[model samples]
Target: MSRSLRRGALAATAIVFSIAALSACGAGNDAQTLGVRPDNAAVSVDDVKIQNAVVITQPTPGVKGPAVVSATVFNNGRQAQTLDAITLPGTSATVKLKPAEGTGPITVPAGGSVVIGGEGNATAVIENGTEAAKNGDAQKVVFKLSRTGDVALEAFVVRGSGYYKGFGPSEVPAPPSATPTASATPGGEHGAEHGGESSPSGEASHASGH
Candidate 1:
């Protein structure tokens, strides 16, 4: 090789070695590294691909409470579609496409994704969840449509810690039940349960009046 070319090659080798050393020093030093993306699971049926799917709630979204699920539903097809209803057959919670305002299904723009149940914006809402609604379980959910057929997906149950903890089952007070307690016998009885007839001194007033 030429003199200048040989020097250029040696400099490039040193730079490559330095870059490798930096990478080795910074192993697993990201801001946050999770074992697996539990919330980033995806399921595809037909041309529809649902990504980052997770049902976020406390433990259970109590009766009339909220069972929120978030996901990015992508329409790989050429046309637009509307998500009519979402149902959790494994749970009692009914799905709503519009949580803020009670309404019908949400529309998915053509070749795009619709984000449901994000932070502060709860799009698909499930009401009236039961004890069976727990965390770390795969819930069998169905997404209904107007024209297209229903699509079933396994949505994971993500437990709440900070912001989404309110959806857990409420600690409602149980109804009061009667319980027996110790009490003295009726009719002015003393500490003793059974006492002899009243003494003459204890029963006097009428004779004195006569």
Candidate 2:
């Protein structure tokens, strides 16, 4: 081939290689490249963002007990926000909040964040929860805030094992046992037998003497 023709062929080969490389790079930017998304739930309402929300229960499946919620709340506004309460819809369970700073509402600092049910952090518990939820289930949780109103999300229910070993609800005290009463025994019958009459032999001897 002539020198000019050879140069043109080389340029065409270089262009083909460049196009193939560009296609490969585009394919690499798919969902897998972003890494694995968290298995928990997340939601944003107004200036508040709740992320990685999950309900953790006892490791035993279907066991009736309390469950704890874990999440991080981010406040993007200039003012701090208070987390008032949490609720589980379509269930009889009640959600109780316990702030890490003792007895008060949980506060998400301005332009900062707060963690719920994390180590040494505030807690949100679902009383008598496992009956309405089980491991591997999706439960609807509502977070009531002072400024953002109510933000709801579908949180995943996970067993308190593996990465969530300490996320389960605190130990609940058992109800007191019923005490025994005097009426529960045969005390009345025994008293009647001993007090109502003297011995039969004693009574007969006294009648003979008379």
Candidate 3:
């Protein structure tokens, strides 16, 4: 073979090897998972407060649909705040928050409160606050208030059946057969009966994984 041809072939071989090495490096990087987090993802309870009273309003019973919940985000402090997107305190739980669906990124003004919910029905989603409360996990609505830096409000999930006050570890939730009846009972009675029972027992109350 000609000397010139040999040099050309060597150069081609070198280029092929270099390309292969780069490709391998790229693949390795791709194989390595990137650190990711949900937006406003910090979940905690130390800094949050019940700025507004935890309220639970029942939809007329037998309404066969996702419950609608509304909460007012008030920045009682002087500074402005931003709410991180909300999440359930469990793995692989599917839920939703209202106002977020229609109004989007709820920005609470300093020393003021904004109603977070959608039209008519507020934000709709399978709620997990009650579940989290029942489980006794850190009960919080993660968000960044204008005044408070990233925070998770000590929250209570208001359900048609009843309410869950989050405080300690996971809760011992009421049974599925009992939830509807439990909620339907008079509010005062329900409170008296399950007043001290706050938490998500980390158990599924229904097939919805709630």
Candidate 3's residue-wise lDDT over 55-106, tens digit each? 2222222222333223445455666566645444443334454343356555
Candidate 3: residue 59 lDDT (0-100) = 27
RMSD of each: 21.4, 22.8, 16.3
**What value does the lDDT take at residue 11 in candidate 1?**
100
Candidate 1 stretches with Cα past 4 Å from truth are 1-4, 13-39, 59-64, 99-103, 119-122, 130-132, 162-210
Ranking according to lDDT, highest score first: 2, 1, 3
State each candidate's clash count. Answer: 0, 0, 33
* Model 2, span 1-210: residue lDDT tens: 999999999999999999999989877655245321255687888898887788877645434567788788888999998989888898887888877776989888899887776457777877777676778889998989898899999988887656565556654322234233334547967654553233111000000000
For lDDT, the strongest prediction is 2
Question: 2 or 3, which is superior by lDDT?
Answer: 2
Question: Which has the greatest TM-score?
Answer: 2
Query: Which portions of model 2 miss their true places by more than 4 Å?
Result: 1-37, 172-210
Model 2 CA lDDT for position 116: 75
lDDT of 1 by residue, 164-191 (tens): 3432222321113312221445555452
lDDT of each: 0.53, 0.70, 0.39
